[model samples]
Target: MPILEDLKEYAERATGLHRPGKRQAAELPHPRKPHVVRFRDDGLVPNHPRWPLTLYRSAVRIDERHDPAAVLEDLFEANGWGDSWRNGIYDYVHYHSRIHEVLGIARGKGRVRFGGNKGRIFTLKAGDVAILPAGTGHQCLSEEDDFLVVGAYPPVGTYDECTEVEDRPKALQRIPKVPVPRKDPVYGADGPLLRLWKKSK
Candidate 1:
């Protein structure tokens, strides 16, 4: 709860807003990467212009100390958004090839399920951390009154990086209007990078 309060205070001081649902444009400093963290006041609002129903995202970065799992919990608890839950049920599905994510839980309790098959679902509490391997399907099932989430993406960005590049037909053509599911989950798979870590193992 202290984390949530701190984030709220930071958001208010940064944007002059008391709630997390409102959108406020602010510049965040990242010594390790070039990125921006946009704060929102409305919970139901979407982070992108195309996806209005998609969950709102606050303070995204590539910091090593701030994991995605921990940040997510904090965001949920601070905004009173409830706990994390399994993917493909009530949570958003990446549906794309493969991507890595780090989540932070600030408040409440929830669980995360990774991969379509042979995946693991982790129960997360306040200050808990979860990592989703690339090409793995992930979702969060909320169990608490509210939950806060802070997510981190790789330097290339989640999904395809080509979409952001101008005048790149290859990237644009390869980009899908909707994300596609991976043939297999990245965790426990035989690969040097895939073997990096496991939520359960």
Candidate 2:
């Protein structure tokens, strides 16, 4: 519960613009909550610093982009350190205002749910992929054994230039109500970062 509280506080502080527009007093829903699977007992890594709540290193990165297929192949490939991708969760929550994400469920069953919306869960199994549009809040629900998720993003420096508009009017103006789909998709060959990860022998 402390972790959830902490996440809530962090989100509130990070956003700066609270419900009443006052500093040091803000409330925001915890973006995503994934039950701590491992890393709680001893630690995520051996002898790591132990705090009241454990924090696992996030494998996913805002800067890294790869192919869904190739990334999946590499995970199971012998030379690719098969066990490296065995099981893990990325603790880091990424917020990309300019880019969308393509998530591919490669080898197991899991759930993806966007924040602020209940009953919008998408359950995925092997070979199933979901495309999450930009600014749509989301988080992983559960990761079954050997669950593998591959994400794709735009080119290097593309997201870096992204601007986060906090002002309500500005943010509203930036986002179009018409919802025209982008020419280049976010998470697959349909995405901008195409073939970044290729199947290897």
Off by over 4 Å in 1: 1-98, 160-201
Model 2: runs farther than 4 Å from truth?
A: 1-94, 115-119, 160-201
| Cα lDDT tens digits for candidate 1, 168-190 | 33322332222321211111123
Report the poorest 10 consecutive residues by lDDT, candidate 1.
Answer: 25-34
Error of 2 at 142 (Å): 1.2
Clashes of each: 53, 1
Report the lDDT tens digits of candidate 2 across residue range 160-192: 112223322332333222132332222212322
Q: lDDT of each structure?
A: 0.34, 0.32
In candidate 2, how many Å is residue 72 off?
Answer: 6.2
TM-score of 2: 0.39
